[model samples]
Target: MSSRQGPVVHKFGGSVLADAAAFRRVSTIVHSEQQSGAFQHGALLVISACAGVTDRLLAIAQAAAAGKAEQAEQELQALEQQHLGLVTELGLDRGELQEYVRRLCAELAELCRGIAYLGELTLRTRDAVLGYGELLASAIVAELLRRELPVPVHLVDARRVLLTDYHFGNATPMIGESGYLLQKEGVTGALQRGEVVVTQGFIGATPSGIPTTLGRGGSDYSAAAFARALEARELQLWKDVPGICTADPRRFPEAQPVAEISYAELQELARFGSKVVHPHAISPAVSGEIPVRIRSVFAPQQPGTLVWHRRYDAPAQPLALAWRERCMAFRWYPKGNSPLAEMPEIVDTVRKVLELYVVAASQGSVLLVTGPSTGTLEELYGKVSFLPHQFVLACIVGNEPSRWTWEALELLRNSDAVSAVWTGVSPVALYVLLEESAAQSALAELHGWILHTHALQRLRL
Candidate 1:
């Protein structure tokens, strides 16, 4: 019995990895899927750190780097107790489970101690410390899920198979090497025996074997990579939301759900600051032509958003909007006989150095969005500071850019709520920067004029 064919890839994020109840619920889900023959050859599960665990780990690492051993120790103890408590609730064998937990705790403590001794947090050391959360969480979750199923469950460390360059903080994976190692290592053999394999997401190893992490929010990309490597039938990402909505439902109560979207559109939405998906996650999915389904953990049976390469007669209009906060704008005033002529070139270089997204740019000014940062703000041509005004990104997905602006954006122009606008490279989405106070109203107006009304508009897929 060759079990059937290849593996099925399932990824769970921090949202469902919170506590003991969540773990049990996930185990029951696995049982139901297994009983339904969801795993043919085998199932490949990629899991993120427990909820709030990664943030805590980062805090501990930063504290240790700043010579705050007491604070770091307190965090370590709390995290250890949390994990042990989950295992206890699962009723796993206390002896071996406790020992495993103790070993991991000891390793984390030593890593923190080294950072404290050095009194400086280098990217490399930080990568090592951050990886522990996924490591410990994957193991605990795998153990609990294993106890819930009668089938064999194998734990595979992501670092062993997902090979990447030596980038310490944010590493890029080597696809060819990764696929080769995954096969040569026993993933195929384990699957052939109908065993479910579990692994940590967002963590990989360099060619020389030093641990590296795929920056924050890289777990989705990790799952996609494995989906391609394992030649999975489908890639399912379990998140908290129902799926990809027209706008973030939190902000717009009337935002509707999109049943299906192309990979390109989803990638653009993600790049434009959609927290529902990671920006880099679409690469492998597109390359392999795999269908990435976004399913909700709370309502598993509900038809969530499905991302594939199929498109019908649906014409693009305004589709979605994402809000990005705490942004900084850099502007270089044009000066006579000034050497700042290369301001544009400087923007290019700065983007490469920081890897932050350039929201909008004009002759002498540019807006950059960053997720929370610890380092001091880097200055450009102008003094760098946060804008006191509120702002949000309003993105409209449509094929005709000019028509979209003329039809749906007329209100924005008259309202003077717009500052700058840019379209994604593929033209699948139009990004408009808006004033914060008017964001809700502007979004509602756009949604009504463009989507709900559907006048002179093509239906969105």
Candidate 2:
């Protein structure tokens, strides 16, 4: 592990590590990388829990808090059995790992009993319960890597180094302090000694060591945080898809993969409706100027999408389309003679409260798009009245969306399937609101138009 390059940070999600076979594949990938001299300076792996484990853990917590201690214990036993089954599938000796899993389960059972007796579930307690999924999953990964790689594999508890605030469910990482702790806790030293480090993602601790989670889908953020701390060469996120696609392949069957994209474009896509990468995951990478590669675990040889700081100078065309269903548009008519300057503050407040996706302000009215969860807007209730209209939001993401905004709007407006449409534009994207019933068909038509138009333009060039 003596080399001229910095270490590489790799993140494997639950979808890619579904079972023992998937874990085996992960080891093979690591082994291949090692053989190719990719880990000369060392490598850090951030792992999510196995598929469905987090949900199951949440259910167990709810059951225990509802005073069904016996049922919670039964579910916990089944979870234990699942891990043991994975151990059997991997053909590993059941002595040490089996005993360790049982001890962890015993502690979980005690917590469940406590919750049952108290009859309450606090976010703090729920976070503690949810974290066990990653703790258990990472242990299995560590063992698998130990058997596969010639170098030493060390399992470091992320809670020891990744410090966050007291926000129980969606805590923000204290990057400066966390970086200092990561170096102080021997993570750098272990890598320098030629050891491959494995750690659980999405879990960190407060100043007093109370466990906290970074919300769902936070593992990508966790991986980026570690990469920033380690100053790694690249941050690789292993997913189940080929790469970032023009649209979700499941919903839009005609969707095609994007070869490369700028950080700003990807950030907008993620923020709007894309699920390929977490919204906050790109910030640290941007700050550190690290290139992120989203690769498929199934097809390891193929070079997937590369997300970097550079922008391409190609002509304007839709790079990708992302949509959100079950959204609502809120229109507010301002009071008489209210200056337009005041709209910005109101929009900012609404965006923070509702996590709004699109906002448009005109002379008389302001419109915002958000999810149906309106109970959180108590503070803004009387300040501005809202007229709710159910709509699905579709965003067209590209480098220079302003260039094709008019053409794209006209295409949507003429479509027989599309009914009423409201539109907004940003530097990187154009947002369209469509009736829920016609959204699917309208998106399909728009996607087809984009592909056909781009192909014809290429021929002319």
Point out the worst 10-residue segment of candidate 1 by lDDT. 452-461
Model 1: CA > 4 A from native? 1-5, 309-317, 323-393, 399-426, 431-439, 449-461
Per-model clash counts, in order, read 2, 0
Cα misplacement distance, residue 201 of candidate 2 (Å): 0.8
Alpha-carbon TM-score of each model against the true structure: 0.78, 0.84
Q: Over the stretch 1-461, how does candidate 1's per-residue lDDT look in tens digits?
A: 11224777888888888888888777877777788887866888898999988889999999998889999999899999998888888787554767888798999999999999989998888888888888887888788877788899988999999998998888988887898988888887887677898998889999998999988887888898888877777788889888888777777777767767777677767766677886476468657777778888888777688787654555545655555654434444434455356455655645644445554555655465443344544544343435556566666665545556656556677766676676643557676767777766776777766546443443432
Best by TM-score: 2
In angstroms, the error of model 1 at 326 is 9.6
Q: For residues 182-201, write the lDDT of model 2, one tens digit per residue.
A: 78988888887767999989
Give the whole-model CA lDDT for all candidates, comma-separated: 0.75, 0.82
